[model samples]
Target chain A: MTTRERTDVRRLPEKQVRDVAVLHAILDGALQAAVGFQVDGQPFVLPMACAREGDDLLLHGSTGSRLMRTLAAGAPVCVSVTHLDGLVYARSAFESSMRYRSATILGTAVLVPDDEKLHALEVLTEHLLPGRWAELRAPRAKELAATSVLRVALEEWSVKVSDGFPDDPDEDLDEPVWAGVVPMRVSYDDPVDAPDLAPDRPVPPHVRALLDRS
Target chain B: MTTRERTDVRRLPEKQVRDVAVLHAILDGALQAAVGFQVDGQPFVLPMACAREGDDLLLHGSTGSRLMRTLAAGAPVCVSVTHLDGLVYARSAFESSMRYRSATILGTAVLVPDDEKLHALEVLTEHLLPGRWAELRAPRAKELAATSVLRVALEEWSVKVSDGFPDDPDEDLDEPVWAGVVPMRVSYDDPVDAPDLAPDRPVPPHVRALLDRS
Candidate 1:
């Protein structure tokens, strides 16, 4: 069983969701996460492509990066992923807010062992760009050596969901204004071929599939 | 003149951009930022709506929140904003990456005085939901009291932009595979009217404009 610590929602306790499925949904849907770690009391947040494999989230970066090195050393870190669904418009500024699903995990990341490094990379590539892992050339030994894969177990995490419509006060609801949601989404456009593409090479079926799915 | 320290890019130095204008552009275009701050060695990253006013970036949160209180106390913080432009696919898994423009700022945040708190809130509202600030009712005294606005000067920061096409090695480039970028964007759909909206109240002109702009 998964146990959580100080992951409770203090500000908006009503919005805190404790279901594990909800946590997985947030993790699987997001393409990237903002990783938070500190160096000499100064915190740094970097954007990274994230992949959720079973109980742990996989994050990869250049082994030479200070943040990666710190994480490999088991420094405390926070992995946060947020999806902005829309802008909530209300009659009053106080009630106006955003509709988002955000999940934050607090833990130390352990570097994936050398024996499993290639498998971790496969998980990341498949998660970030589905079906491309099978099409692309696998990472060579040198490439794996240059990359650092950190996996943080999903032991302590919190998921907050704000998916409701604007909730303005009764008095404000009577105001002659439109108060609702402006839904937003991220979409993929047509893929552009590389400049030095070999002749007779067409966009791969997997790439074309992405457009269809989008 | 702005002085920067410890903002140098250590890994992949070619992607680092030191131009202040580029920093401003990244800050101005983003609707939200991931705020990183450490408390007792456990780091937390929260999603925050950001507004760039002059040389300072304003962030607001509940006054009762610990993160807000810590930041108000002038604790070191890192505010990062990233815009994902596209997904880069290469012939090899090692060469594949995402196209993104990310900016990270390191500094201490000061609480905006009570007198200036309202203006700071307005800046945040306008930046996040452009043109909606003027239409909504201004915050009441109680609401203003419950909110805490903090400003961090952009004196030390760095930006990393990855806009180039896939840079696969010669051997991989000749592989009979498609390698290019699939453009991505966040856009808004039609506004969904609230169920309890006043009868015959039309969507505001400002809200309607969002769809067109997107």
Candidate 2:
């Protein structure tokens, strides 16, 4: 079901994704998002760490931020998550492009209730760093007091998935250059321990696990 | 040299970068950028392939797009480029964050002139996938007519670099958990040939170079 007025795909209708699962996957796979809001006639976009909890996307910013305050008051915002998948090299300059999955949500956001602030923070922490939430110390009261958490319902959104090969026109196919997708993958390097760590402390199992998996 | 009003780094002042070289490097290294503009008080952020040509950042969109049309008329916009460097695991949830290099440029954008549209496209192609612009067929007249290229001057911008280890509070540092940065690197996989390629055609040297370098 698409919110036809707000979430309808206009430019590339073929790449539009309406499945709820696909939208969730793109959000879950990304560690960060670009959040945009306008002040007067100018728009400001900030790259922020984000997390999706069930149907609402959670984002945190300094309590003193004007943008955060504007968003907390239910201003319309757009949160966009993009995963760059590959580089598509076609036989023509016009056809060459990138492979990416991008989801854009357009809606007004409300501030998270004070009672759920800690839980929201936990959701954000766990979603971003997986197992680190349980191992790390809980947020202090002052820390929680200084942060603002906002949630935008996933009601009006559009997901565009472009994972296919380059679509060169029939005549351009024989242009005498190789054409294909060069897949881009992100690999995690070994963790570098903090310089201030105790001499006896070693890289923990959680950090080591990323090395093995990535 | 700092345009404090527009480019001030508000959240974490210490991480703010004012060097033009670092800003250029971040833009040069990125293949895409999230461009944000507002229409009727609602902000829209779209992912588009980007190229930095000297002091102007070039982005192309369909001529029929409302955003593109507004931008072509010199609407104020925010173009943000972010490179996610790693995940920072700290001793406390409050201290955990991501390491990234982010540059945000705030300015009005002008449409590239008709005469220079092709050159701008060439700049984008060469910056995105080097060594292939000379090998590919140039865009046809109809294709050029359908594309809209906009350039934003890099006059007022700020770069934020967060590359340091987790800065956990002193008391939390002994929390019995490993803390460090898990670096994320993007690498290219072996090229997947297009399905319709001629049997005798091979992956070109330009495409093979990415495999060797990445």
Candidate 3:
């Protein structure tokens, strides 16, 4: 675990450095994250498809992206992942809240070295579609040249989680209010096989497995 | 609409602004959002239940919060909402991307005046669980005093969205690759009625409707 200062403790109350397993679970659960940073004194945030590769996160963009260029210049960046578990219906409107788990990482991003970019790309690819990497063609040199990838180390981070029932106000507990949780989840629907897919080419096992869980 | 200067786009790309409707839809559809800001040179991000109230977003926090104070003091802030539409499987590992719609609002948040706090709270409650304000007990004076609500005007905002198929490199298009979209959605499970509820007290129609859609 990495040790870094967490300056704002009130909004971000839980500052415990999460273990690697916890961090991985949070990253794996959310397929996308909001990446926030300041470019020329203006705050800019862009959501990108991301995957965790060892101790860093792989974020990709077109080579001409201003976001990529700003990050490459060693500007500070913040990446946030959130999962809404349930809606907390409290006895009073003021006490209503959501049960959720979120992780925020603040760090400087470095452009991935060419030698390691391919592997990072593979991590992202497999993360998006398991078993598809081996079936797909590799990137040509020029195509790879046109893309830029950055790895932001997850060093200074915090995870704030709120779970279970709503914290109803004492006076409103017996006010004839119906209060409970409405569970929220993310799930996949049946895959729509590609229109161009050959009739004989069956859907791959990895893709089929997702539907089975549903 | 409130014509605040912060809502005015300074360096915003014209093409991106034309897609503003898509951004509004993304924010409306997102179940959760990460609110980010800096306090004394340190960064913090918190996942909060949010709702769009007119042209602004309503975010609730504890009245005694250090973060709310920082925000009310005119510190820079970023609120981001994202919906992961699908996982885009591509012909090459480098071309794999996720179909998503995201909006980031950059501005300083203003604390909702005490007189207007109740209306803001109602907007949040109604947004999370429709008809919840009427179903549940209203906040007492002290409870209302104990909570703080702020609104971040969505004036200076940008929405980035990508949908449909992956933009894979041309050379990899026919390489025996299975490329398509794995659609994702956020859903609500059946609401759990409170254990102490009276048998005659039926679940409200608003709550019951979300069950079948789940």
Candidate 4:
């Protein structure tokens, strides 16, 4: 599949993936993104909480911020999400690399209308905290007013996956060094109660569910 | 201390950090960064292996990549490094957030000249793989030729940290919901040997050192 000039992974074209499912998989498993936008010909990239809803990727931002204002006004943005899966240790420094699943989406973000803002908020909150959204109180009107939800259609994007073992050349194979992948993953530590929390409050099952993942 | 207009953390001025040591600490502990650069006003953010050497942040890229080529020509770039430390579960979804250490550096990236490319390469490799650099064979000239090392001065940078407990309002305190942080950390799984490796090869001490860290 031919991608537009912008979404093309020109550096390692072989690693570029055109599959929509792959793109969704990367987005579905991600909660954060480094969003890039240009201001006065200079690029600024900042971390933002994100969620994918239907065909659009939802990004939560402060309405007062420049990036959010620019994005809400339809400036082009690049959202990047990456999962560093492992470290590939080859026999030579040149051949050593990382195993990762990376996705980049390019689109202008449309501001969620005032009426849809509440639903967008639920998606954003639920996407990050899952079941906790149900037990939480509704967002205050003031809180909703301060939040900005920007949705970028997932129409133009690219995904790159590099998950193989060290691909050292044949000449470097006999170098008598161990070659492999040191797999990496994110895990949750025990939930720590807030300092002011009442002593009687037990940790919620929803939060405990985070640690249940093997 | 006043920061450059570009480096100002305008979104939440209170979260901006000025200490150079804090900036270095964020960079030192980080290996992956989302580097943002522009072409014809369209911003692009790509993940790259990074290392901080003294006052400069070194980013590794393929010579043929558009980002590298643009940076090599002294185009402005923004490099963002973030460690998502934990999930903050507040009583209200509006107050929930994440604990993170995020740094943003904005500057023009200068291409490391040919004479210093090897040293830059070492910093990049050693920063990511640490002791593996000393154990690996040297990078061949062709390999060196294909890699581009761009250095962005840490001069124009801002670090924002959000590591505290969820700051729910006083009125929301009695909501009878568990509120706290679910800490997150990255850990390595046992190393998996390359399929082509000899069965008798043992994992190196340097690689095992990775797992030894607390």
Q: Score the docking of each candidate (DockQ).
A: 0.82, 0.80, 0.48, 0.85
- Tens-place lDDT per residue, model 3, A1-214, is 1244452345535534356677778888766777777744455566666889878888877667767887898888888888888887777776677777777888888898788877877787777677787887677787788777888887777776777676654656676767788888888876665555544555678887866664
Please tell me what DockQ candidate 4 reaches.
Answer: 0.85
Q: Please write out the lDDT profile of model 4 over residues A104-127, one tens digit for every residue.
A: 998889999999999999998988
The sequence of per-residue lDDT tens digits that candidate 1 reaches over residues A56-174 is: 99998989988898899989999999999999988877788899999999999999999999999999998877888888776888998898889999989999999999988787878
Best by lDDT: 4
**Where is model 4 chain A poorest over a 10-residue stretch in terms of lDDT?**
A1-10
Q: Which pairs of residues have clashing backbones in candidate 4?
A: none
Candidate 2: where are CA atoms >4 Å away? Answer: A1-3, B1-3
TM-score of each: 0.97, 0.96, 0.88, 0.97
Alpha-carbon error at B137 in model 2, in Å?
Answer: 1.6
Compute the lDDT for candidate 1. Answer: 0.87
Q: How many residue pairs clash in each candidate?
A: 0, 0, 2, 0
- Model 4 per-residue lDDT at A50: 96
Query: What lDDT tens digits, residue by residue, belong to model 3 across residues B83-160?
Result: 777777766666667666667788888999999998988887787788789877667898788878888987777665
User: Which candidate, 1 or 3, would have the higher TM-score against the true structure?
Assistant: 1
Model 2, span B1-214: residue lDDT tens: 2347657877888999889999999999999899999877779999988999999999978888777987887788999999998999888888888899999999998999999999999999999898889888779999999888899999989899999999988888788887888898788898998888766678878878878887
Error of 2 at B148 (Å): 1.7
Residue B20 shift from truth in candidate 4, angstroms? 1.3
Q: After best superposition, candidate 3 residue B206: deviation in angstroms?
A: 1.0
